[model samples]
Target chain A: MHELAVTREIVDVAAEKAEGARVRRVVIEIGRLTPVAPDCVRFYFEICAAGTAVEGAELEIREIAGNARCRACEASLELAGPVEGCGCGSFDLEILAGRELRLMELEVY
Target chain B: MCDHCGCSTEGHEHVHEHTHEHPHEHETSRTVRIEQDILARNNRQAEWNRGWLASRRLVALNLVGSPGSGKTTVLERTLKELDGQMNAAVIEGDQATDRDAARIRATGRPVVQIATGTGCHLDARMVKGALEKLDPQPDGLVFVENVGNLVCPALFDLGEQAKVLIASVTEGEDKPAKYPHMFAAVQVVLLNKIDLLPHVSFEMDAFLGFLRQVNPRVRVIAVSGATGAGMLEWYECIRASIH
Candidate 1:
């Protein structure tokens, strides 16, 4: 639902970066913990980027894997879905990385 | 549509009509290295709002939670208790209707309502626009009642000093565990509706247990807006934040 707003921001950023030039490709990074869906982003990108410099541009979404460590057992593992509790029967955990939401690079014409 | 040099085509592709002309090398095909956050605009706006509020010494608290987390109830109770002693204002963000704003106005406090027709969360731009129309006391509290959504609201920065989240006992004890982002983002959580503790099966220790796991620094206060339980402590928390 909020993907549209975030996509608008992405398109707007790409447009600003183009500075009136045409966009060819856009590279975006999303971590596993981030709730943004790559599919939804691509869908909204079509609408928000229409008739703009980013229109029809290739949207390359990079999904980063989430890494976390269980606080109870000190076990390191990949974080599961929102509802998935740790294997150690403890909700306590430390997120090491993979929460990035960034627009890394843009190819423009 | 190309923005610069005014050379746009239906598609990004330019078809050579008859002869193969040297591929025009305009600053067009260059890959710009921009390591920027996708939410740069919003983050920048949030920074602007932060500076604006700081200039006036205004303390803003962005209240966010599930739709029935007793956010408004908490605010209503707080305003009722702290009315005369503190001069506070509200910016209500409801999907539609000014009912929440009207409810806050009944307390005789200045309030502004921002109805996001389809938007799920309150962004920094909306708060900046609201600030332009109302005149809250300098160094006063600005409570931005974000649209009742734990997920989307957590992603937005409304330039508030803190995010006050409330979850009723009626909801699942694992509410924070389910919505880890919101729990981790907020500075405090008001475990509201404790008055019905007997009627509900919500485990206090379990709820606090999950909360501690997600946000060790976030303070958790038990309250019941309906019965005015823990209102004084909540007020004290607000006072400490402002001063």
Candidate 2:
């Protein structure tokens, strides 16, 4: 799947950040609307990280909640996933957040 | 005493204790603030490709759909109808074959075939490479037909002006609901194979309702590549877009 490619990128990024040091942990933030499974990422990370600087690194994934604002009423709301309309009966909504997939930090030794 | 990091015995509790007694002393372990997007590389390439296309005033559209959804047929039909009116090229992406490229070549259009091997989707870098090989003329239109996939292809940005979803009625009415991410990411939906409406159990009302629920602002065009029905509207849409 594409998760394999994504995981490869994560490892390369972490390894580049670590320089010559060994990475202990890698922290990542994934948004709810990104459509990537944390477990699938983890599965690929283990394989991609093998023999790299992040070989034994522990992966921590944080899910960011989806946030949106109504285009008509300008009212902000949290969504579990992509929704049809806002509570104010407005089908026009602008997504404010929850499409992020970032490598936040790396603990290295 | 803790067994993990080997700090002192006093007030260790079980967390990592990096507090040294000396003022200038430092621990070997450190946390680096990366704060980088995982898709930064791909996004950078996509931006470059976008700028390159914009400088030439060229338009690129990425077409995505499930296999057997008539994506190749749609392109073949588009090229046939828009033959002399519009100058266009095709970038065909598949897991293995260049058969689609041969088909597009038969239409007398420039074509490049990218075989991803085991990869499921085409990334921005792949498109950039293909563009260099094809080297389309200025002010021309480029159609990057992504590998037939409803899932992973939606996640990648190929530096196209917009993504068009090709769905056939035989795939069912709930495709938009089943793959909301793909539906949400596309700017237009081409409901292909409409000529089979009488034979299939597909309901137009339900399909439109589900598509609207998933993406409120997407343009939907119902067409049949085999019958050439409603293809005039498609050519008109293309003309309207580039002009």
Candidate 3:
């Protein structure tokens, strides 16, 4: 899964920042529409963090909801799922959020 | 050896013996708001690959679709029809076997096969390797037939000039809605297997409506590789892109 690849990058970036410090927890922000499965990320984070500074560390994920602005109706709406068109039947909408996958913070000692 | 403030002499002695203590406190928490995109790295690689291809003046198209979407058949007919007019090379991707590559090779064009071996999609790095191996580049079309998958392959960018999503009528009219990301990211939507339309209940209006809803900018071309219907326009699009 692509989540595994993303997890590897997270682990690499966290380890680089840790700089020999023992990591206690890692917090990540994931958007709902990012195409990455949260369960898959959690499963792979364990595998990727093995033998690294973030080993056995807590993996925290905060899911962000998808938000969009309708161009036709000029209404801001939170997407329920992956539906693209607006309530006004307009596909010309701009995505605001919920496509984010970022490593937010790290707790270390 | 006893001190007035020491509770335990052994522990106090160890504490006093450690002289490398720093006065400043270390931060226990560090915040890094790395709002980096997950696909950013892959996109970078894809851009690099694109630059390399562009430097060589090669036109590459990433053909994406589900299994049995007539991708290979379309390519076969394309090569046969455009013989001597366009010099084409193929980079065939599959989970296993060189069957697609073999078929393309039979068309008398240089073909390279990248077998993923259980990987559901082809990443930019894989294509980069294929391009490196197939050097001394030709000046015409380079078709990268991605692994037969609708979902996973849609996420990966293979450094092609255009991403072409192929969906046959036999699959159903709702494919564009079901796999909107694939359709949304593609430049051209090839509706293949129109020859079987008479045998199947494929609604053209509903399909076009769904496709437009997902991506209004995507150009649609319907063709039946088996019967050679509506292939001229497809060939013209390819030729125009190459030129």
Best prediction by DockQ? 2
> What is the RMSD of candidate 3?
8.1
Q: For model 2, what is the alpha-carbon lDDT of residue B7?
A: 70
In candidate 2, position A74 carries an lDDT of: 95
- List model 1 lDDT by residue over A6-98, tens digit each: 999988888998888889999999888787778999888889999888999999998888888877799988864433447778766677766
Q: Candidate 1 clashing pairs?
A: A20-B3, A20-B4, A109-B28
Which residue ranges in model 3 land beyond 4 Å of their true spot? A17-20, B1-29, B136-138
Number of backbone collisions per candidate, in order?
Answer: 3, 0, 0
Candidate 1 chain B: worst 10 consecutive residues by lDDT?
B2-11
Q: Give per-residue lDDT, candidate 1, residue A46.
A: 88
The DockQ-derived docking category for candidate 1 is acceptable
Q: Write one digit per residue (lDDT tens) for candidate 2, span B5-111.
A: 67767556565568776578655799899888999999899999999998988999999999999999999999988888878999999999899999999999999
CA lDDT of A45 in candidate 3?
A: 89
lDDT of 1 at B161: 93
Which residue runs does candidate 2 get wrong by more than 4 Å? B1-27
Clash count for candidate 3 is: 0
Question: 1 or 2, which is superior by lDDT?
Answer: 2
lDDT at A79 for candidate 2? 77
- TM-score, structure 3 vs. true: 0.85
Candidate 3: pairs in clash = none
Stretches of candidate 1 exceeding 4 Å from the true structure? A67-96, B1-28
* Model 3, residue B239: C-alpha shift (Å): 2.8
